[model samples]
Target: MGILSRASYVIRSKVNAVLNRSEDPTETLDYSYEQLRDELQDVKQGIADLTTQKKRLQIQKRRLEENVEKHNDQARQAVEQDRDDLARQALEKKKQKMSQIEELEGQISQLQRQQDQLVEQKDELQRQIEQFRTKKETMKARHEAAKASARVNEAMTGAGDEMEDVSRAIERAEERTEDMEARAQAMDELRENGALENQLDDRSSLEKELDAVQQDGEVDAELDTLKSEMGKEEEPTANGGDEAAETELEQELEDDTVSDVEVDDSEVEAELDELKDEE
Candidate 1:
């Protein structure tokens, strides 16, 4: 083919493909049904027109028949009155009327035949349209059911855009939830490890250490106060025993001092001589 012819063919094929894709069977069927109805209406109109023409012809034929009868009566009268020329003229006019009536009858017959054919065609077309309507409705119902089933299948298989979007949303939500959970767990771990204390607390590390030392000091001071309080509580119970032991020690010391004084002089002289000899 020439380039122009090939281009035209390609264009036509593309247009046909587009039309096929865009065409709905239900819509096509409805359009065809409407076209049939319009054709039927046209056929009926034609039949009506044909019938009208036939009626006009019939009326004209009736008038011609009446004229023929009037001419025949006039011819008889003319013969009774001895007017042969007038009779001949009247007869000639009657013959022309008869010829016109015959022609009108033929035309009427032809119109009747056309009307009859059109009526039959109209009836057949109507019947076909009715049958097509029934089939179209049945096919449309089946198509709708199939379309709904296909949509459901696409949703179930996550093949549809909306279903795919939902799947993606769920995945995103899961990812976000997992990330949040991981972040929360990490925060908990950091808190447990005391690594987040500086971030969470308003204190510097040095300040925190100072606070800890202060707390320890306060605890030690409180411990010392408790020890002092306990010792004070026990001191009253031990004071009487301490005073009795002190009196017993003082009595023993006085008795030993009196005995030492009684032996000192004699013992001193004798001890000095014994000490010198032993040396």
Candidate 2:
């Protein structure tokens, strides 16, 4: 095809596609039904007009026939009275009326035929309108049902943008979780690689020595308090039997008392090891 022709064809196809998409099947059916009804109305109107003309012609023909009968009676009365000229005039007038009646009859016949044709056309149009209406209604219902199905399908399918947003959100959540996990692992590595040494690095040898001395003083004070409490519990009573009962109670209370002191021999050895390591 020529370029211009091809371009025109493309434009026409596009326009038709757009129109097809925009047009609703239900609305188109309704419009077609309305058009058929309008046509039916027009046919009925034509029948009415033809019937009116036929009635008018029938009335005219009837009047003309009455005048012809009146002329015939006048001719009979004139022959009896021997008035030939008047009778001839009456007959001539009667002939003219009969001619007019004949013309009117013809006109009435034509009108009747036209009325009959229009009536038949009106009936056919009515039948067609009814049939078309039924079809249109069916089409409309189907179109509505199809449209509802299409809407449901569209919702089920989901919009690309919403799906994309969900995907992006999931990706972001995964990325955030990975970042948190990496941070946690890194912290674990820092701890495993002796992060405590880094904190100790912030102190000078003099501060370490002072801290050990302070810790020793606190240990000594705690030990003195424990010893004083033990001495009070172990105080010799004036009675030997009371002293034996106190010794038995002291053995039972040792576990409880030591739990509060928190300064076991292992802890003391660990403190000594820390001091040596620092040196």
> Which tens-of-lDDT digit does each residue in 42-145 have in candidate 1?
99899888988888888889889999999999999999999999899999999999999888888888888888899899999989989988998999999999
Q: For model 2, how does the per-residue alpha-carbon lDDT over 192-271 read when each residue is reduced to its tens digit? A: 98553556478877887899999999998877776685575445578888788879889879977767655689988999
- Regions more than 4 Å wrong, model 2: 1-8, 159-279
Best candidate, lDDT? 1
**Against the hidden reference, what TM-scores do the models get?**
0.73, 0.58
Query: In model 2, how large is the Cα lDDT of residue 150?
Result: 77
Error of 1 at 157 (Å): 3.5
Model 2 local distance difference test score: 0.85
Best by TM-score: 1
Worst 10 residues of 1 by lDDT: 229-238
